[model samples]
Target: MINRAEGAYLGAVRAFQNPMLDLLHKRHAPLVVSVLSACFTAERPNVSVADAHTQIGDALDQLRAAGYDESLPIGTSRDLCRQWADAGWLMRQVVDDVEVYRLSAHAVDALDVAGRAGGARARVSQSRVRTMLDAVERLAQDADPDALVRMARLDAEIRRLQQELDRIQRTGAVEEVDDEQLLEEAENLLHLARELPADFARVAESIKSMQRDVVTALRQDERPTGEVLREYLERAQHVMEATSEGRAFAGALRLIGDPQRLDGLSNQLDVVLRHRFTGRLAPQQRTELREIGHRIEQGLDLVFTTQREASYVITAQVRNHDPLRDRQVDDLLRDVMTGLQTWMPESRRGQSVDPLRRLPVAEVDHLRQTAGDLRPAQPPAPLEDRDDAVVDVTSDEARAWGGPHYAELDRHLVTLADGRSIVDVAVAFNAAPEALRRPVDLLGLLELADNQGMEETDELAFVDAVRPDGTRRRLAFGGVTTRMKEAVDE
Candidate 1:
């Protein structure tokens, strides 16, 4: 409702409550609406009260044409009649059985205050006899008495709310309400949150605990080496994602109270899902860790890398293929048996660790006897004890000592490659026939390095292991560097 002037509003209410106004509405309201709508829409000069319904319809049509599409659900005639009557702003009459509508006195009273010329009420005087005329003629009232009654009820509601508006305007401070005070309820909620139940408090404690654990894990240098460090980093990354999820849950708690569904299972589940480091380890993972740790503890020197000047920063657990694993196990077993060879002579073969260092006394004596033992061959040659590690035999020696198979090896027709090129063939050689080509790749050269360890020996032998003829490429001793402090045997 538009804010009507104070006088107009009070007058409308007075008119509405007045019993006379009720009679007045019963008489003229519809006719007045029809005429007013007609005149407001009256683009033309002549309009009859008898033509009020048509005029009202024309006005509604004009409104439609003007793009004001307010829905007039029922016929304009009856709706206009009902609205004007309800407002007590018009009057109705039947002249010659033809319904005509015009304005009423009370409507004039209110509209005069609303700045209307004469609300809807008007009267005509003819010479001597004067008569009252009003705008109440446009009713087809017999059509639906119930509809009119309903509109009357709605009109009463309108009057009631209008009066309520008037009362508010008179003294209520509702319009200028303060926003800060409005947020008082939320502040009360915050106070309640401070006094949280035991459940939420427990959750907060657990979150703090988790924060401490992950933070501590990040702070510590628990990973002793690169591989171990990488594994630790992987675990950290996994748990960090878990922490992100936990944080999400924490945020979600702000929306939905403490999570009750998983609350009981939270602590243990968090350890498994959120903690990065496990205090305990499985037997096998523990064994691997210990072995790798020992390898580290042996000094970073044990890791021999291919790039001579490059540091062995990366320790790849050699790809665990079955053939490789089997070979490693067999080598280990062979080493064990070799170490106990003298006691367990059932071992057909006895391997040497550095033949130059661990010389056989008997072989030393024999070499002494051969040269009258003069100077006693102080660095006695490996007369009998030699490793199957470094086989260094030239063509003539290969023929004389290695026999017919020696020539076959030169062309690779015979694949007796392991340690073949490094060790003197007369002292040591591989007897395995590569009939199926399995030993092709891992055939390390038999390097005769002056160094005392197999790692250096292997590294040196590996660097300079080859027969110039390229027959056994496995003896990759094609390297050409001079004998340095730790020079590999060529």
Candidate 2:
């Protein structure tokens, strides 16, 4: 058998290894504790990532200004927060598309420890002793194996309460608890109330662990999907029974699940706060009593949110589970791990390798889902006999209907030029060949002029042109004149 000293030594080792004790043993424990307490409160237990970073940075600056610089961590708020998260002091999660930071169970425990140690009132008090005694008595009465013994205990309690009630009614005088005792009891209750957040966090963390385990089992494909799903379903349905913390919280939830129950608690707290004894209590303690119901509600909300998220994850995975794909992913991951192991022994120290940032896009081809005849169901109608339908067209008429002769127009413009001379677009159009003098040719001349850096005139110009079919038309547009270039500058 181990001696008491050895047992105590082993216990200390295990306790020190816990994240909560680790936080308290930190080099800058005071900074961590004070900053966390100032940042998080019962009213706002979690903060958005940006807001948390900003608040922490401000707090750090304040500390530095106070000449506690040497006691502070050596980094920006963001870096420090990330470090804390890695060390299990904070829980970083995404809520409603926003990343937020909440005190982890370990952090909450650490804060509780710091708060208890900061004051002399945390020492054993009369109310605390009485509370424990009453709890033990209740436990013993409830756990008695003999029905007669349980009934006798209940009878004794009822008689004692009845005797007090009769005396109060007979005398018409009610005895009140002393202010000092009331304050002590109130403080003891607050200590217990302060632990709710840590308890809620632990339950949420437990649910998450169960969810992760179920997902891993699903991906392994070692069991049938139905079997795995059934196991998860049972676990989800009886989540409270999955862990000791959850089971205890489940009982507390049942007691306070009713809205009226919480309202009653709040009313009682309000009555207590109004007493003269409350005036002696610190402002923080007064607020804690008043907001106790709200604090419990917030903790419950957090736990419910975690439960819903876990359920959603499991449902989505079950709906989309693919054994073949899971096996493929596992194979690929194994290959990657093997490659890394092979390369590690041969690699140089401090050497780095670039990561694959993206995978090749999947290429898919359109496929015809149905078959249909390429040819028409019926033969086409014979061409209409139109040999004598339109016999009035001539070559000149057809040429008039065609596009402008740009080549002929260019040749005419070059021939009319007198060595880099400025030619008015209207004049050039009038001098062009008859076949190229269609109204469309006027637009071509304008385009060519623009290409040669034409100069605009304030006065409008008109172009007179004859179509190949002897049709005359007049086009009016903005004046544009260009300097004709020699063939060498073409």
Candidate 3:
């Protein structure tokens, strides 16, 4: 018999090596691969047959224009889709009288691999080293039970860490990285993030497969209910506890659900994107990151929902086949009585009288008094005050209040010229009419930064201004610049 490890390996290989993949590798099947990629690139769960045909048509047109003279009619594209479905690379379903096609789990894996093979190179980061070290430590701890030995190893690790820190402090060294390198690292992080969702999709498929197996077993098996239930539980337990994928997925689920970790990751990415070494992300890149984040969250949700659905199915099946539920309480009680009678002697099977009935009434009263005396005393109740007091309900005298300070900042920013330091502009604004003589504080300047006309830059400036009270305040402000008129004209 093939062992479970061998079976799993073979199953994975079979999943990836579908006939459609083989066909796509053929010399004349380049267009087929392109069509599949175009259809699946949207990361959607499914596409309608008509939509797929249109996409394939576009792909074929592009291919034909590139010096390929193969005929690719809509009908041929449909036939190829059917072949893919037959090869288990796609699943076809009828929805609302229209046929739709979805990439199977295997197809998704294959496409992901193909895309990555042609994509940019991966970059290694500090997190990789930390993860590796953590994994190695965990393995060591699992392999060795001796606390002293572990402590010795930990001491050595601490010394090495201290030595590294000392070296850094002594050298006062800094590592400089180029913008291109940082951008590459950011791309790598995003690539890793995308893979997390794909892994979740695979796990969700596995869970669905497990659900189907359980249903089939429950429906087809003729064994005793307890025996069948035991088998099912064993299988479920093995999947959850013994499998590597299950453990890794469970860990990922926990990490994703942690609010602190998610916040940390978000902050880290924002810092990287906004850092002086990296610069701001393009609008399209930001959108892509948001989409990937959403997909990851959705994938995690899918895993949870799939598991819940599987649990519900198992529960329903178990209830339907439950032997305990089939036996009434009365029947169970009768059986117990029959067993008791079978074990007892015929003379000793008479109805027994209550022993307490034979006790004297005076003794019962004495016992009740003793039990009452033995009970613990209750604590005293809290005191309640009955005093009342009157209070004034009049509003305070109205005082002159300035409107939102930021509104003045916005008006001042719009009136200023572009490419001027923030301090020079602030000084000019203060000298202008309707400008606040109190001078805009840092908080007010930050509020200006949020205005459509103002943006923070690396430029800096200082200006001295006087308050309405004639006190001189030296202000340092100027990272903001403006191009409001240019934007509006555009």
Name the best candidate (by TM-score).
2
Residue pair clashes in candidate 2: none
**lDDT digits (tens) for residues 92-111 of candidate 3:** 65544677886665666566
1 against 2, candidate with superior lDDT: 2
Give the worst 10-residue stretch by lDDT in candidate 3: 395-404
Tens digits of per-residue lDDT for model 1, 1-490: 6556987988889867863355435544343434463453212212345476576777667766887555433456657656766664554534344555544434433322332233322222231121112112123334446887768867998999998899899988456424343233223322222222222222322333443443333334344334444554454334323543334334443433445533533453343333233224334333333232222222122111111111111212222224456567768898878777755664334454444666455634333336455464457567676588666676654533332343343333123334343333211233334321222222321222222223223332332222424445344443221122222354
Q: Model 2: residues >4 Å from true position, as ranges?
A: 1-4, 237-244, 323-490
Worst 10 contiguous positions by lDDT, candidate 1 = 302-311
List candidate 1 stretches off by more than 4 Å.
Answer: 1-50, 71-75, 116-490
| lDDT of every predicted structure (CA atoms) | 0.39, 0.85, 0.63
- What does candidate 1 score on TM? 0.17
> Per-residue error at 395 for model 3, in Å?
85
TM-scores of the candidates in the order shown: 0.17, 0.68, 0.49
**Number of clashes recorded per candidate:** 40, 0, 0
Indicate the TM-score of model 3.
0.49
Ranking by TM-score: 2, 3, 1
Ranking by lDDT: 2, 3, 1
